[model samples]
Target: MQQATPLQARVEGGGTPTMANWSLGSEAGVLKDVLLGPPEGFRWMGLENAAWSSLVRDTLRRGYSFDKQLAMRQHREMVSAYEDAGVTCHFLPLDEYNPYQVYARDSSFMTPYGAVICQMANPRRRGEYAACLRFYLERGIPIYDMVSSGNFEGGDFNIIGEKTALVGYTDHRSEEIAARQVAGWMKDEGWEIRFAPIDQFYVHIDLMVCMLNERCAAVCLETTEDDIVDWLKARQIEIIPASFKETMALGCNVVALGNDRVLSTAGAKDLNTKLRAAGFTVYDPDMTMFTWAGGGVHCMCQPLNREAA
Candidate 1:
């Protein structure tokens, strides 16, 4: 077995028990799978607007280096958005040399205890895990675990609450039971975890659901499983519903930036209004391309660390 990265293994001990904060570079981790072509399912996928927002295929082409620069500027703006919200956003280099932009492979999972670097099932995305794992190691972060199960992605994981997460394993990607392991591990560590199923088209649960506060969440009821919805409700988490149409546009993909605030894509007006009514400050940046890539503000960012509650 490979030795853990410096970040994966703790040093003798020190620091004020600081939590980690992480985010992905648009140029390095954006996907160009044929399956994402034309962004067919979403009528809003447009390259024109993608210019300043999404990390599109053309942005990686040597011929469109200009577009790449524009994309980077927008990416920087996105980082600034996070910083303004009291969330620290870190960026690594854009690994476009990798044909699939899979340079910094791994899921965006950071826990108070440690970070669990993922093992991507897709060969194209496999390299990224190593890159991120190495980063955490060099930076002195502890490694929680790696998804050696040969099936996992950061997209499938959601931090519903600290210590408790909902890991979704889609029938089309990984075994449904794979997530059960997460719950098991969390339980042993005084954490709680649940496995939830999301449609393959949605990619992961985060695309359709997110917690806005301790008692409120924004969900696209049309895509979330009935039971999971019920379970959430049982916890007194008010489910603020979004329309399937908006959800398909990646409107359901929102990032919480502490202080009852969230960063959203442009078209999430209806959901934004709802969140505002419920008490939240919403910010919409240049998301044309980010939205086209089938990921919105949240997918574009991997919250590496958050302050412990």
Candidate 2:
């Protein structure tokens, strides 16, 4: 596995890449550079009252307290885990206004062409992508394009392999029009897009399916459509089914660090045990506090550079 050059090192060695142009061809590629949302910005600002998902409201109603200091510590450990895997981790600038910005994966996605800025579904998250745009511009990373159709979130875009992406649509977060528009862009880029219709209970495609390695995926079969499963099978992707109980525990929301390694929460024992049995090195970090804000490991990091397998 090859470690990708850090953005700073890339700039210093190659003299600032072209503005708005970046390259990320595969999700299971050797991860070199990544963007981890800053946990320092995690704050409870009463936005839960107006949360788009009843699940989030329910979590809030349960009197779940999110500790900012603890979250920061947990994020540090996760970053350390990435470092141990030879991944270069970058972070988003803190935005006190957008507390949920810590889920960096929802703001933008990296493609072979460049970064595609997403149009957020929630009003509270509308400006988070702008911060990512700023980082790309300042660091000389190219911006491939921006989503203009209805509402789109990066969480719905799941890159499975080279030249392929699994895009999802949930009425609460991503619209079919938005998915179609993304599919069009991918088609123009000479890539295939598998449009997956998601259940309302889940937030994104990543929430139900995560690529774990070159040929394996951690999938929540209950919410995954049969056609989507067939598509994965057609591509020879091995499915590691996670039960509904494990899915609610965010077991499917794992992050692949290239090789046969995955990062997940310590609470995801069933999925972790299965992944380990499948020869994957699982790194479980305690991120229970982060989930209280309504997401898991996969939601916190965005891959900036992946060496195509």
Candidate 3:
């Protein structure tokens, strides 16, 4: 087991509290602690600009109405499922009402040293980075650094191995410059960075590629760049290809809990079958309604501590 990195909470005056052990390395490590966003105050009824928002636009475009209550239920179920898996879970304090804040993965990126606060592309999400930074600070977690050069989000990063990371840039969300900035930081830490150029349609890299275990990955071959595939092949990582339709359904957004265990959406039947066939214990939670909001299991979670495989 890897030692926990303490999250030192800032005291009232100036000094910080005794740190709590919190550590996160790879995406598929044995998840021991996690941060989940609160789903309260997530109403769509009072929003004037809901029409242009990606969540609302995508939901309506798919011929479905946005249901805040149902989404909350689904989120609660996801948290419960994580708890059932013996993972210690933490919820982000609801300081203010942010509709899209339920997707906590976008707020910050967890590195071996500490958390890297990201600059969100969406103006509405920009505040989340600061909120997450405050959360870590108040808890005694060190802040490795902040991505100030350009817009970046945690969803664009996938830590594959102890010293390797797979990052993506969607022209609309995670800019190339910001990705390069992240690459620079990782390189400084003696890590190899694989830059994945993703299509503008996909929200983040995690939507197309998910690490199932130490040497296995679930990839959407149709959308994944050829170079990424080649890179994974060179790593000797087994690829589980998902169809285009399955990709759209967020089939590749499964979260690995280490030990060949995965948390996936019930809607992704084909992918779940494949995972089970590959000897993975697949936990299917009905996140169909929640995913309609434009993210899946992996997007909703931010791993805070995990043991290396």
The top-ranked prediction according to TM-score is: 2
Q: TM-score, each model?
A: 0.75, 0.90, 0.89
Name the candidate, 1 or 3, with the larger lDDT value.
3
Q: Rate the local accuracy (lDDT) of all candidates.
A: 0.58, 0.80, 0.79
Worst 10 residues of 2 by lDDT: 7-16
Per-residue lDDT tens digits for candidate 2, residues 1-309, read 744323332221223333333457777877888897777778755554335654476576788876778888888988998999999999888888888888899888777666778888888789897789778777766666678888888889998988789989886788899888878877765678888887667878888899998899999888788889989989999999998876776678998888888888887888899999999998999887777667788888889887666
lDDT of 3 by residue, 1-309 (tens): 854444422222333322247666688888999888778855443244343235445566668766767877877888888888889888787846466667789878788777878888877667776568667877778877678888888999898887799888876689899999888877766779889877667878888899999899999998888888898989999999878787787878999998999999888889999999999998888876657667788988889898877
TM-score of 1: 0.75
Question: Clashes in candidate 1: how many?
Answer: 17
lDDT of 2 at 172: 70
Candidate 2 or 1, higher TM-score = 2
- Model 1: residues with Cα > 4 Å off, grouped in runs: 1-70, 98-106
Clashes of each: 17, 5, 9
Best by lDDT: 2
